[model samples]
Target: MQDVPRIIKAASLRHLTLGLAALLVLAITLALPAGPAAADPGDVEAASRGVVRVVIIGEEGDQPVPISHGTGFAVSPTRIVTNAHVVSEATQDDTLRIGIVPPEGKGGAFARVIAISPRNDLALLEIAKGALRLPPLALAGGNGANLGEVAAVGYPMNVDLAQGLDMADIFSAQPPVKSRGFLSGERPSRQFDTILHTAPIARGNSGGPLLDPCGRVIGVNSFSADSSGGDGEFYFAVSLRELLPFLRSNGVEPTTNTLPCRSIDELNAEERQRLEAEQSQARERMAQRSEEMREVRDKARLTAQMQVLAARENRMALALIALIAAIGAGYAASVWRGDAARTTQARLAAAASAAALVIAGLLWITRPGLAEIEDRVAAALAEAEGGPAPEPTSPSTAAEGDLICTLVPDRSRVTAARTDDVALEWSADGCVNGRTQYGLGKGGEWIRVFAAQEDSAVAVNTYDPATRTLRTDRYLLGAEALAEAREARAAYTPPSCGVSDAARTLGEQQSALIAKLPDRPNERLVYSCTAKAAAR
Candidate 1:
């Protein structure tokens, strides 16, 4: 009985010991791995759009029941990628049906199994033409970097059970769950290439996309280990090495992105640096112009003063010479008073001297003043440039005519969009492509805002003519937000081109709506534009 107290103490400390070990493990996992930045909410939201639920339906006594459920993601507009086991029963039995529940909307869609690789445990299903359309997730060019951050997006069955959702609810569209963790390593499975990650996933999460911080598809979540052996749960995803060939063999072209993953904070910081550099350059330019103007003014003043002084000295000398000539002529006339021809010549000389004296007085009275120095400087500077100095104008006002705009990747953050150059036709009257009218925004930018009905995306496009920069920001909204945006769009009427006041009013209205949007956009594209030369 003496060891009873010691046994009790050990039992009590068991829970504490386990708890401390768990904490230590968590701290190590979080602190040790040098991974990409954490996932952004906007990026996750955008990536989740393509994630769907793959439900297997079986009919029992004329009643349809969901026999199995798993997750899948769009690889193309009409093709979905999922695990072979998810639809294996349906493939074996023709009567079994496969249903796809999108991330949004009212009802589910039916799809046909196009390709199934049992060895790789992968399958491709094609949705009916024009039945369902979802933005395909962009696959990462490589499997993934070790210890990098990753997110798994999918519809887990445990969640449905926890929410107590019925079969009908399962068919209805709903958003998927996102679990974030770090990539452990590349551990190829016995059957196929696989990437090992720590992103939590359940049975129903199979075939979902494992994404990077930038919302790029790094791998396809397929399965998880049965036991972690004291570590946290680890999951495995099908690597792109296997997925690429599988997709190509099926003739499905997947969108792949090779750009490095960057967080919004980094992008914002870079933008701030760029703006500061521009401001510094602008200040330098202003200082240089001020110096040039000072030099020009000083030079003009000196030249004008020298010219005036020379003119004055010449006038005084001419006046003195004329007086002396007049005195000589008077003396000649007196001496030659009796000679008529000499007297007439002397009289003519005196008249000419008197006229010269009047001209000198007028010249001295009409000499230029100090104010004329500024005028001379302006004229000199204008002459040097071959025209009057141009007044500074807003960039938006100067961006007109046909322009070829190339992507400024350093100044932009692109998640799922293309980097192709854009051709724009702009008019000085705020017309785009000669049809769509753009409103003048508060920042002196020409802006156009629109929300697509086909997708839950709102886009704001802005153009700064001064910088010749065009920017497009896309917001992937949820159901409620999309509804609100649609309502806002319905209430507003776009103004016609050339109506500055109306366009400004519309811009203000749109700006108010924009203010209500999330701080960061899902995708941002910036293009530097140049005018297209006229065809000869």
Candidate 2:
């Protein structure tokens, strides 16, 4: 391992520990070797020959960006396998470019994507015919490759002479840079269908093959262990057996080959500087937002304090007023003497006391207003903090109105007849629409009585209990048209029950009569009705 920064090294160690623990448990339970077996230098070198560096190029928001870089191995003389996400956005004709720099500094051939499987993030590319000397690595068998086997492979980010070479254009690419790590664990059954282990891979290392000690390909180096940074410390790979099915599905067979090895150092100084700048800017922006939030919170606290002070002042004022009134009453009672003088003084004292009591009572009742003030302050604070307000009761309307009718029982029955409907009479004020009305149903579901008009009074048809019918000398409007009828009646005055008092009395009587109606499911019965005009 090359000397790297402590932070990077620490992060690498942490990842190694975690990866090894998971790998060890999986190996022991599955009866695989706990560590990767060491591979021969020649065999490792041979396997590295097929490893190829993968470069992805595409347009990002009008500018061409090299969005992804990874490694791949030639499965056949003409076919290379790489990670699916590497060339996802590229079209078939978008230039499936591949490059290989031999150990002796020779260029290799380019290729194009033939098939891709994003579900597993694997893609197969087709190179030009008869381009390379190396064959694809041989895939290991079932019962799978041994765990802890030494896997040697090179990745794009690994330090190598190829770093100086125009990697952008290389044919017989140098063998993949080599890194050795033991198979940490078996791959999950659901995804790869082959075993996996912890090996150090990097960003530029993806799609590289994971080769066993004997130069047999067991897995493809697809992902890395360093999730935080581009340090080629620990790695993950897609198993070769898993790759085979996908390759076979697309009608291609992987071949065995030994490629040359190249060493590439990790990120250069310029890349490190750029990454640091970005991270610093992000931290500054976060700090600024935090300060803004603190300021807003301070403003809310100040507002709440002001409201609390005001409420305290109001409470003090009320208390002082009560105290003064009590002192005045005592002084008045003590100074007066004689019958008339004493009586007058007593009355004055009593009046003062009564007034004070009334004031105190008002203050006590309105103490909730102070509480409400606090609540309002709290609500404002809550709103500042982005919370919902409490629900409040409906407000009352102060419009003047008149009662339209009154229903009275016959002299004998205090409780109005359950079956009988009292007559409805209405009186209208002189206004365009000023008639008081009363509904006679038990639950206040009103039965229309009289229309609003200028009339003094109008009688509804008599309700007959036997037929359950109302007989009227005059036509009464239906409930739907009651509003218009009431407007019209406001202008007319009927002689008998036109007065406001008479209407109110009649409305009360009708309400009483309706209250006596027998309770029945879904039954609505009207006992009495009245209409009166609005108050002046």
Candidate 3:
């Protein structure tokens, strides 16, 4: 019994603490001043995602070792741009291999030097687009890095030197070293378009991108003219005027964003300010409505008091007059009692006086009170819609943000299918003449996506390896829907068998629950795909 009381006391204390904490948080939230706030976007970090460390592998003393290396950035999903010299060593012989160290992972993917512009020291490298899909670096326009503005971006070199690292450390992982400086001037260049900037870089930084404040690549770092010994102070980069032409000629089209980049921090601050201002405005409106209600309520109360007081005074005055009349009638009745006609007249007068007194008494008792008027006023205010009700929060139909995907072939699940289902028509360059492939691993199961020969229909196959069960669902959609579904996610609720309603794709069972789609495959075709790359 004692322990029970102690436990109850402790629980009460905990609840009190929780209530206080919640109130404190609410107060803080309300105290924030209305100001500018916006969404924060990490553009610098996003740009760096496309930047990769290029390594040219060659023989050193008969053993294959890293020959030279530079930086390269993705202009498209499959294409990368770097300095011509970066892939020059690989061009000499088939033995030289070029590999890329992407920003995220430990290992790398191999790239083939696709195009070269020796005149401008720029080259484009092609990679297996299926292996990696990084956000392309947005290119700046003709009005590139401005004078006296800060230039900053990822670079290599000067790091190992500063760290006192030896040659063997070259193969080790190297993250991009960020450096910033002013754009001194554009050198008087006749060879090709160039930008002269004081952005700090090193020997291996030959092909690294020079970025503006919003993380847009304004120029490609090329060469440095030495005036003071060792490393130079004057560094020049290939400007967009020259670089854009090279990209166009090489069939490399990079995406560009025209809106000036805004710092994420500034955006977030702006958003917070806007939210606070909205809350403050709502509070002020409520306060104004309350003040108006108070004024109306006070006026009604005064009016009700005056009306009731007048009714009470009238009732009292009528009752006194009635009383005087009754007394006069009684005296007259006594005087007139001597004669029959006078007595009859006296009786009628007495009866009339009695009726008047009764009426006055009833009026006094039933008169409306001040409290009743106030109650009516309060009820009327309650019934009135004080102000416009706040809009209800909208319910989301689909998941927010983007359902970004890296489409690739289901290598593991392909083995489970019959050989006839998926003919191995993969070429050396990872393309098939008549088929397309895309799939994703989900819930420890493989979901294969297939496109028909005419590209008129698309199908999804979910396979259960453990049970060797294959479930195929097909849909015939317009080109836009098909293309959108491939790059993004499209899902529907799966049919349930004594289960909860959850969203899913094709499964073993198909019934009334599943939508009846049109123009599908004849028999689902036991869904499988040829793992061949498609050129986007």
Candidate 4:
């Protein structure tokens, strides 16, 4: 029994020792302070306390709409920072409200806008007096926090749940919305000055602070993932450090200090009127410049049309002169043939020939004018119809003419139903009726026959003449042959035989024909027939 009491005492001592050790540990932990336990590494609560939610409502069409909802943070005790787009819908007349929620039991507070920077999409708001006393977040320094470690905080989609206090409401009716991601890289140069990589942000997250691990404001969440099917979970933010200078320039200080109260009604009316006048002036100047540009374009179109008309008129005058000269030459030739007195006839013939020469000279001069007029008219018509003008084809480039000839029995003729591929043969000198050595036939053969003269010619159709009937070995010439034959027949007579006027007209016609043909590898002399040969 005595040993039991001793054992109890021993057990009590052991309990006391254990208690002392535990008390010592407790004292040390208490002495260490509450900050380290509560704060994340490299994070300070003072930097995150100012973060807030921004809400905007304005008139869209006929109804009041929730134009925007985004995040913002207090940089000073009275001033908050957010994206300009967030409050853009709120006009000077519309109500611009901001909600500031702090951690713990600190209830939400409201604020009004002080100034907005539209170019950078940022705004500064002044918290109303008697509002919640919120801690301010510090803007990170120029060495801007390293790229890979940043945290974004905003009400996000769970804002509705945060608005009303019901744990059941948050769990049952609302989705649990908490997302986190790391920064991927530093933004490229100022073209895209500040960009951050985090889990894709939601519509409500723009203007939210992208906090560094230390809880310092590094960037402001801006855009979310693009719909381009790339890595869609990426988001971007504007660096807070870069935005500080801009805010200061606009008369807002960046320190965590609040200003005394002043309501919107306190501002003088004169300043408001001046701002409105300046905006109106800027708009008027833009409208005037746009009108001037339109006038200049109209003038250029009119000038082009006038140039085309002038060229057409010049060609028409030449063709008319050629036609009149041809008629005069024919009349002079008939007068000379009717005079029969030997001596008087010779004199009359000479006078008639001189008249003809004058007519021919006129015709020669006008022939080119006539053809040019025709071409110009065709071109103008094409232009008016919006069709491409036909290019003048040189004789050398002319499509092969149709073959025309008398095929002896047992001989062949070539025919082309379509003009493109068939070949035409005539005298080597290009005279249509001159003798031909051989002719192209319809079935793609060459037919040869004896001729009265080496220059005697014949024509035959070279490919398909018609669908069912093949005109192989048959000679038939169409319009192409008739034109060539007429020109050749005219060339056979000497220019000196008729009245001078007639000779002149004929010479002009020949010159015009030569001009129409393309240059060839071989030169050919014009044909001539003596007066005796025609009489015989």
Return the top candidate by TM-score: 1
Best by lDDT, which number? 1
The residue-level lDDT of candidate 2 at 356 comes to 82
What TM-score against the true fold does each predicted structure earn? 0.85, 0.38, 0.53, 0.34
lDDT of 4: 0.45
- Sort every candidate by lDDT, greatest first: 1, 3, 2, 4
In angstroms, the error of model 2 at 222 is 1.2
lDDT of 2 at 239: 68
Question: Stretches of candidate 2 above 4 Å error?
Answer: 1-37, 57-68, 92-105, 130-133, 143-145, 158-172, 226-234, 255-536
Candidate 1: clashing pairs of residues = 395-465, 395-466, 396-465
Tens-digit per-residue lDDT, 1-536, candidate 2: 12223212221211233345454454464675354335655556545556666655444466433334566776665578877766654554353333443333355555678898867768888876666443455665433444556564655543533466432333334446777766655655445543445555554666677776656677766654443433224456676556878899999855432321111111124336756897899899889867876676677557766766676668668966886896788667656634574888777886787788677667655553435545665565566656876575321111122322232222111100123433332222211123434333343222334422422122332332221223222222222233344554454443332454543344444543233322211111223322233311
Candidate 4 residue-wise lDDT, 1-536, digit = tens: 23423322221101012234334433543464332111132133324445665655444465533333566777766678887666655534444344444433435556777787766667787777976654456555443433334567665644553586432221121211334555555554333356545444665576777765445566777665433432234566766545777678767665421111111122224336655777788778767755654454344334434444454444445445544554564455566666564556556555655665565565445434324544555554455446885677543224223443222212111111111222233322222223322233233332222111212122221222221111222111122433464465455443332233432344443443333332320111111111222324
Better of 1 and 2 by TM-score: 1
Looking at candidate 2, what is the lDDT of residue 218?
72
Q: At residue 445, what lDDT does model 3 achieve?
A: 48
Error of 4 at 417 (Å): 99
Writing each residue's lDDT as its tens digit, candidate 3 over 380-423 gives 56655564465764212111111212212221111011123333
Q: How far is each candidate from the true structure, as Cα RMSD in Å?
A: 8.2, 35.4, 23.8, 38.6
lDDT of 1 by residue, 1-536 (tens): 34423322321101112244444545766777487678886787888888999988777789877667788999987899998878877888897889999988785789999999977878999998788877788898777855788999998767877999865577788899999988877756678887777788876788899998888888888877644346456677888888999999999988887766776678789999999999999999999988987887788778877775676677667666766665665566566667776777767766765665566566555655556666777787777556886898655567668999888878788788778888888877678887788887887778998886865578899988777788998887776787788788877788776665766777877876787778888878889888888411
